[model samples]
Target: MEDNYSLYEIAVCELIRRLSNKDDCKRYHEVLGYQHRLNHYIIKCRTHGEPKEFETQFNEIISQLNRVSLLELNVSFNDICNNVSREKQDDVVKQIPFIIVAMTQSEAAKLFENYNESEKLKLLIDSISKGRKTTHFIRQLIERYAETRNKWKPFEKDSRTISDIINDLLPKLIKILFPIREEEANIDLIPDYYESAFFSSNLEERSEIRDYFIQRDCIFIVDTISLFNPEIRDRFLQSQLAATKPIIGILPISKDSMAACEIIEESIKDKFEWVYERYQRKLEYNCSLEAYSLPSFNRWLYKILPDIVKRIPQAAPENINKMKENLKYNSKGFQKVVLSMGGAK
Candidate 1:
């Protein structure tokens, strides 16, 4: 029999050969095939019998493939080596981090492309929370994720609690994350765009929105109406998130229009709705989401709108002023959402 090499070993050989011949670059389909092969190869190498030979060969091939130093990949590889025991029952824990760090943003994304329900949370949590006991790290991960993908959520008028969380916690985290003077990086965590119009509100537009959220590793919180009458909005949110698995945090409204702000507190209560919490204690603030009045949120949102609008083509000069106005008006409605919660506690 042809040296019973696991699929990964064979794949490593094929990809290395392809890279050497530089053929994968020429064949577009091969690019896709290469990724599948790479994933399967990693899985096989990790779980199959005594992989020292495979690892050695894989390392040799990778050495040859190395054209540039990938800090993320190197760091991740080191992390894997420390965590896993290849000699044991395929304890491939270490490989997970390496695969995460090694792949280009696009390649890393493919790992989740075929994820089943149980597997999705692992990806989201590892990337954001890192299974650490620090809310600071988790929050920064969310913000950095937002910034990297150009998704910035301007604090809504009703997101007084969220605004407080952002303003109070964000600066402190930035200080820790960017310790050196040169390490400072401007990050935006809000969505690139937001349409209050739910799923039934638009089809093509909703799909685009879903894709946007998925790419950014984000979640959505539908307005209060969804909480009261969830049939349509819930379906809309689900349909939108079908392509991309973002947490959908639903905020319940009081329907008084004036008491709409209550949704902010309720939304935090429903934070698990955004991302499932197998262990609820792991959440920030004990998942006790605080409340920040709408004015507080709008102040920050309006401050950032000018700069944000400048980059959006759809937001023309005429529309810029209009958006600013809309933000102010929205802030009022949002404020109502927050203030309504005042009676609760």
Candidate 2:
């Protein structure tokens, strides 16, 4: 497998996926082209043929990514893995995305494991944020989990907001662990829905929700007001300050919202620098992962180019680069490599 695809092709593709948006991938698509090149260099590594589904998938994902803020697509860290994984799983070389090689094997394992478990995604994310190695099978497990997760379900309309994502998961955590509850446990005459109440944008309509929390003597939910609209950011803070007579403990910010626009613009610039930094952390993460995958492809190509050079390299320098570029860069490289090898086989 190393002889066929080369780490260069793998890594480059991973990086391109990170940088490319709908308007133009430019260098991003180049990585996919390199994947096809790898096939020509090594007989076994060549693709069987182009895949129709991949074209559709790439177009759809890239188009959506272009429309939204690039910052939001920080989740593209797993794009290369997700694309490859969507194919089939049983057959694997390292059975890990090239990025996995960047992490220690144990760290890789934890990443993959957490990635698979719904409960562990937050924990895994926290670990990654802290720069901790949370697993050993990161690479292999990424391949398995990426494919498993990519079995596309329709997008839920409610999932458009950051709050929606948290709401979907938070309730499950509440049910099983019961980690957070009121200090003085009391069965309320009316249910406590303070979390939802405070975020209401309509000032006139928020009276009921504000009264609900005050009635419960809840001082703050820790950064809860950070989720409010920009127009109301200050208003919410002022109201909360006035309403809570005695200053209490800190409010907890939702982990997901930490990277949100509201939080980023309003965040303590020094403490959470990544939130405000010019570089997109997600894109950087993807690039780092791809950097790790490159050497493997280089190692593979080092072995195979001798044979192919006679026909291809001898033909034209432009052809060589184009072939290599396509194999290693383009989305079709996935199928291109297989077909390239199948023709040789």
Candidate 3:
């Protein structure tokens, strides 16, 4: 499956999606034209026989990438976390529509496990950041947890924040765990979120829909539990669109994934249209609501890519992290799962 990458096709579609906004992805129409035509050829490759004309499409991408200074649609953890204001985070989210990978509550919990911390943080960061990649910090992360010297105690709360970790958890753990000054005990840069931010049985619990700079590097439940409620639906939608931190709902490849978005119309009183496109090989699926759009088709391609989940590579930090940065999405539950894309960042 590692060899089954549709690299050219994915790159072209990603570029085209970046150019669509007309405001931020500013470039001559030629780049956009090639993207559309390239996507057309990709769909044709799916249906009809592969076209030799694909060479022309690939060539056009290379030329435009150089001339237009190829636009990469990415929002960093620092992009939102660096800013501590409601207005600034809102502006960032507004400028770049955050991607949501809708999935089940149990899946979120599985990812929440501490054993998966190293790989989980990498996957969430890359996906929410729209394939921003670059996860060299993972090696340091494993070392930091090793310094903890004790097992990660499961906190039974619904969620946690940077404030909770730094002010409370880290200090206590650092006394015995870290081998540095308390003030300068540099924590691993593996950003994280606790359990599902929207998971609740009642409106009281549900109303705590978190969205801010604090929630910037988080992954939580985006299941139907909160999606069907009117207020929760509206809040969740707003968070996805306006929060500096991306909230992609990575749903399983089931009807629930489809209904997750469709229920938006049922909860609200508007007619929301969801447009989706099937990428090459019928393997990847991407969708978005016209009223509330995300960055790109791949942003909505939330499925675990084939071959992304496999045995952990040898204990070499630099090569492993470089391999991981390319990966956009990876499912949890593997022994040590890390995300790796087909190319360099």
Per-prediction TM-score to the true structure, in the order listed:
0.26, 0.19, 0.21
What is the alpha-carbon lDDT of model 2 when measured against the actual structure?
Answer: 0.31
Candidate 3 residue 13 C-alpha distance from true site, Å:
50
Q: Pick the candidate with the highest TM-score.
A: 1
lDDT of 1 at 254: 21
Tens digits of lDDT, candidate 2, 13-42: 454445555366665455455445433433
Model 2 superposed RMSD (Cα): 29.2
RMSD of each: 23.1, 29.2, 25.1
Q: What is the overall TM-score of model 2 with all chains considered together?
A: 0.19
lDDT of each: 0.34, 0.31, 0.33
Best by lDDT: 1
Q: How many clashing pairs per prediction, in order?
A: 20, 52, 15
Candidate 3 structure quality by residue, lDDT tens digits, 173-269: 2243334443222122121233234434444543455434343333322322223334445545544422323223322112333443344333332
Q: Alpha carbon lDDT of residue 332, candidate 2?
A: 19
Per-residue alpha-carbon lDDT of candidate 1 for residues 273-341, written as tens digits (9 for 90 to 100) = 443341134443212222133433334333433332233222233443444453342421211111011
